[model samples]
Each structure stands twice: as structure tokens, then as C-alpha cells.
Target chain A: MNIKAVVGRNVRRYRELKGISQEELAFDADLHRTYVSGVERGVRNPTVLIVGKLANALGVAPCKLLEYKETS
Target chain B: MNIKAVVGRNVRRYRELKGISQEELAFDADLHRTYVSGVERGVRNPTVLIVGKLANALGVAPCKLLEYKETS
Candidate 1:
């Protein structure tokens, strides 16, 4: 899968696992709600810096955003 | 440390470990040599998509790019 899809999927998964809303995540990441939504949809590509910010907002390591676990 | 610094440091470290030049990695990642150089120098921020490409070029997982091992 493409990196965008990987990131978006993980972001959504983690966000849901944390029980946080997109608006809250966006606020934590200092981004727009629309931007977060777009990212979740794989429509926008975020830079490394942005990834870090998102990681911080999500209370995870930046690498966590990039991890893709295959389902059995 | 900032995300840019983390990514740049890791990219350079991985690139060196693989004995690959920035130019070569750029080619593999479909990026410009200058862009790779900038990324290594922590002067540029790459998107999640770019991170994926770079990880692929380096033969590593995208999460590896985000990992920061704290030195004791």
C-alpha cells in the first residue's frame, strides 16, 4: 500500500482506539480539522514535521504513525 | 528534538549504514538530490508519502524512520 494510505489508516485506527475525536486531535496537533480529515482520507500528505506534531498530539512516537501491521 | 531533526538524523544514519549516497537514495525515492540533501540536513520536512518512499528506498519500514533511540 502507498504511504499515504498506511499513514491514514494507522492514524484513524489509533485515533479511534484512543477514543479521541478528529477535532480534538487536530487541536492537539495544531492543525485544521479539515486538514486532519483530509489526511485520514489519504488525500493530503503530511511532512515529517507534521508527523511529529501529530504523534505528539496522539501521545505516541512519530514512528508509531508509520507502523503498518499486517492482519492474518 | 523536533521531528525534522529526528527524521534528518535517521535518514542520514540509515543511508550511511547502507553505504548509499544521498543522490542514489533520491533516485530510488524519486526525489531530487538536493531534496535528499536538504532532508538529511534537517532543513526540509517531508510528507508522510515522501517518508514512505524514502523508507522503501532504504529498505526499511516507515516506522523505522520515526524511531528515536534515546542514548543512555
Candidate 2:
């Protein structure tokens, strides 16, 4: 799978795990709701600083956002 | 240490370990030399996609670029 896709999927999964809406997550992360949506949809390329912001909001290590699980 | 600083150190360490200069890494990673320099200086906020590119050039997991080592 593509790296962006992995990042998007992990972001979505972590967001859901936190039980927060996209708007809520965006607010917590100090980002636009549309940016959060774009990230979840794998259409946005988030910078490391942005990733740190989102990870801080999600209460996970920043590296968690880039974890990749390969599928056969 | 700050996240950007950690990232920059890791990138520089990995590049040096690979016996490549920043310019060579930038060339192999298809990034501008100045961009890599900024990253190494902890002044650039590179996107996740850009991290993937650098990691690919360095032949390591993308998360390797984000690893943190706490110094007391």
C-alpha cells in the first residue's frame, strides 16, 4: 500500500479510537476541518509539524501516524 | 528536544551513516538540496510524503525519520 494511504488509515483509525468527530479533532489540533477530512481521505500530504499537532490531539506518538502494515 | 530537531538529527545521522552528503541524499531522494539543508537545520517542516521519499533514499522504514531519543 502507498505511504499516504497508510498514514490516512492510521489517522482515521486513531481518530475513531479517540471517539472524536473530524471537526472535533481539527479543533483540538488547531487545524481546519477540511484539512482533517483531506487527510483521512488520503488526499492531503501532511507535514511533520502538522502530524505532530494531530498526534498531540489524538494522544499518540507522532510516529504512530506513519505506521505501515503491509497487506499481501 | 523539539520534534523538528529530533527529525533533523535523525536525518543527518542516517545520511552520514549511509556515507552520503546532504546533496547526494537530496539527489537520491529527488528533493532540493536547500530543502534537505533546512530539514537538517530543523527549520523545515517536511510532509509525510517527503519523509517517505527521504526514507526510501536512505533505505529505512519511514518511521525511522521520526524516532525520538530523550537526552537528560
Candidate 3:
């Protein structure tokens, strides 16, 4: 799987686990809602600093956002 | 600690463990040597894709480069 996809999937999974909306996450992460939307959709290639912000808002390790089981 | 610093430290640690120099790693990762140096010094805010490349070059999970023990 693509690395961005892995990150997006993990972010969505964690956000759902927290029962928060993307808008809520964006607000907490101090980013635009559309930016957060793009990130969750794997369309945004965010810098590590942006990843750190999202991870902070999600209350998870930044590395956790990058984890995925390979299907190969 | 800064997220970039954590990644840099991990990159350096893994690179050293593999007994490779920055030039070797940069070549493997298809990045410039000076860019790799900047990354190791925590002076670069690389995207996740760049991290992926570095992780691939270092033969480790991308998440590993972002892991660090909290010291606060």
C-alpha cells in the first residue's frame, strides 16, 4: 500500500475511535478543515510537522499514524 | 524533543547500525547528500514521502524513524 494511504487510513481509524469529526480534528490541530479532509483522503503529502500536529490532536504517537499491515 | 530531531536521531542510529555513511544512504534513498545531512541535523521538515524513502534506504519501518522516548 502507498505510505500516504497508510497514514490516511490510520488517521481515519483513530479519529473514528475518538468519535470526532474531521472538522473537530482540524480545529484541534489548528489546520483548515479541508486540509484535514485532504490528509484523511491521502491526497495531501503533509510534512512531518503537520503530521505531528494531527497526532497531537488525535492523542496518538506520530508513528502510529504511519503503521499499516502490508498485503503483499 | 522536536519531531524532526527524533527522526534525525533514529535515521543516524539506523544508518550507523547498517554501517553506511550519509552519502551511501542519500544515494540509496535517491536524495542529495546535503539534504540527507540537513535531515540528520533536524534542519529539514521532510514530508512523509521523504521519510518513506529514507526508511526504505535504511531498511526499517518508516514509523521507526519517528519513535522516541519522551523526556519531559
Candidate 4:
């Protein structure tokens, strides 16, 4: 799988788990809602700093956002 | 330790281990050198997609970038 796709999937999953909307997450992360949506859709490539902001907003370690279990 | 600091430290370590400069990694990752520098300095937080780009440029799994062994 593409790494971006994996990241997007994980971000979406985490957001849902946290019961937060993209707008809310983006607001908390000090980003645009559209940008957050693009990221969740795998259409935008985010940077390391952006990851930190999102992780902080989500109350998770940035590394936790990268965890994707290998599927057989 | 701050997560951003850990990320920056790890990024610098990996860049050195790969014998690549921040400029080289940024070019390969399709990012700005300044942006990469900021991330490496822990002055910026990266998003998940950015992590994907960096991991791809570094020829590593995105999750590998998140690995920080808990120092006792």
C-alpha cells in the first residue's frame, strides 16, 4: 500500500476514534479544515511539523499516527 | 522528552546514517530545505502525509521513523 494511503487511513481512523470532526481537528491544530480533509483523503502530503500538530490535537504521540499493522 | 524533539533527533540521526543532507532529503521528499530543517530542529510538527514523504525519501517504513526506544 502507498504510505500516504496508510497515513490517511490511520488519521481517519484516529479521528473517528476520538469523535472529532476534521474541522475540529484542524482548528485545534491551527490548520485549515480543507487541508485536514485533503490529508484525510490522501490527496495532500503533510509535513513533519503538521504531523506533530495533528498528533497533539489528537492527544497521541506522533509515532502513534504512523502505526499501521501489516496485513497478510 | 518532547515528542517533537525526539522526532527531530531521530530524523537527524537517520539522515546521518543514510549519508544524506537535509537538502538532499528535502529534494527527494519534495519539500523545502528550510521546512526539513525546521522539522529536524523540532521547531515544526509534521503531518502524517509528510511523514510518508520523508519515509519514502529515506527508504524506510513510515513507522520506522516513529521508533524512539524509551530511554530509561
By TM-score, the best candidate is 3
Q: Candidate 2's residue-wise lDDT over B4-63, tens digit each?
A: 887898899899999999999999999999999999999998988899999999998888
Deviation in Å, model 4, residue A66 alpha carbon:
2.1
**What C-alpha lDDT values do all the predictions have?**
0.87, 0.89, 0.92, 0.80
Instruction: Give the residue spans of candidate 3 off by over 4 A.
Output: B70-72
For model 1, the stretches where C-alpha displacement exceeds 4 angstroms are none
**C-alpha lDDT (0 to 100) for residue B64 of candidate 1:** 89
> What fraction of the true interface does each of the listed models get right, in terms of native contacts kept?
1.00, 0.74, 0.87, 0.69
DockQ of the candidate models in sequence: 0.90, 0.81, 0.90, 0.49
The predicted structure with the larger TM-score, 1 or 4, is 1
- Judged by lDDT relative to the true structure, which candidate is superior, 1 or 4? 1
iRMS (Å) per candidate:
0.9, 0.9, 0.5, 2.9
Model 1 chain B weakest 10-residue run by lDDT:
B63-72
Instruction: Score every model by TM-score.
Output: 0.93, 0.93, 0.95, 0.66
Q: How many backbone clashes does candidate 1 have?
A: 4
**iRMS of candidate 3, Å:** 0.5
RMSD of 3: 1.9
Q: What is the lDDT, from 0 to 100, of the residue A52 in candidate 2?
A: 90
